[model samples]
Target: MAASVQIVDYVEQGQSLYIQLKVIDAETGTAVEGEVRFLGELLYGELIHEKKSPLADPVRIETIAYLKTHFGR
Candidate 1:
């Protein structure tokens, strides 16, 4: 029963980038563990990129910092 998702980590393989997220349950205010369905998309100009994750959990904050730096956002 997750109400929202938060970025947990970002990974790069070759030329592709991947983002990991944590599903948060609104009722308990805690992250749901184990495999969970995930769908995400990124839009750049006229092109769109999509990704999915079956299982995701918490990761170091440094991962998020890296993403911010890499994306210059």
Candidate 2:
């Protein structure tokens, strides 16, 4: 027995993507439907700024600048 998936619908809103799917069971020829949503690409990522690190100040300054440019105050 095997299963196959077919895309039933798709949608995009703001920062999210929604998908609807239909799956069929080959053995019994039964079909099921479901929906799934995924958040769009990640923006800023993880930051490791140890207080005693040599590049701490530089990293902080750069992060601030980036935030101001992208997200405003």
Candidate 3:
């Protein structure tokens, strides 16, 4: 069964925006729930001068930058 995805907006304590992706059953048009593990490429950010901040992962930094850019910090 094909699943459709949509982003539900959310904000974290660090003032970063998050996309709560929802997976829906394509045929029945129902929100498919229960621990759905998804593998996806981290969608945004520029690899700046390889320095480290509190954000330890590259994907986390990228996602935060993406949200700030897209949603306006």
Candidate 4:
């Protein structure tokens, strides 16, 4: 089954933006209630810098792809 993601919230603290995401199984549309954390930088509403979290790799990748596709680089 394919997976999908939704942006639940965005919070800015200092120079970092904390993204909260809801990851769902596409076929079932049921959310995976897992907490993932990522550290990244955004410039002028665009994602210009990024760092990764080992525990949240999949979610982080999805979030970055989503931001780049919808919000631009």
lDDT of each candidate versus the true structure: 0.38, 0.46, 0.38, 0.48
lDDT value, residue 52 of candidate 2: 34
At residue 55, what lDDT does model 3 achieve? Answer: 31
The parts of candidate 4 lying over 4 Å away from their true place are 27-30, 35-38, 41-64, 67-73
Where model 3 places Cα greater than 4 Å from the true spot, the runs are: 1-6, 10-56
What order do candidates take by TM-score, descending? 4, 2, 1, 3
Displacement of the residue 42 alpha carbon in candidate 4, Å? 10
Measured with C-alpha atoms, the lDDT of residue 16 in candidate 2 is 66
RMSD of candidate 3 to the truth, in angstroms, is 12.4
CA lDDT of 63 in candidate 3? 38
On TM-score, the candidate that comes out on top is 4
Model 3 whole-model lDDT (C-alpha atoms): 0.38
Model 1: how far residue 60 lies from native, Å: 23
Instruction: Give the higher-lDDT candidate: 1 or 4.
Output: 4
The ten-residue window of minimal lDDT in model 2 covers 41-50
lDDT of 1: 0.38
Tens-digit lDDT track of model 1 for 20-50:
5555545456554332211232312110112
How well does each candidate superpose onto the true structure, as a TM-score? 0.30, 0.43, 0.29, 0.44
Better of 2 and 3 by lDDT: 2
Cα error, residue 11 of model 1, in Å, equals 1.2
Off by over 4 Å in 1: 27-30, 33-73
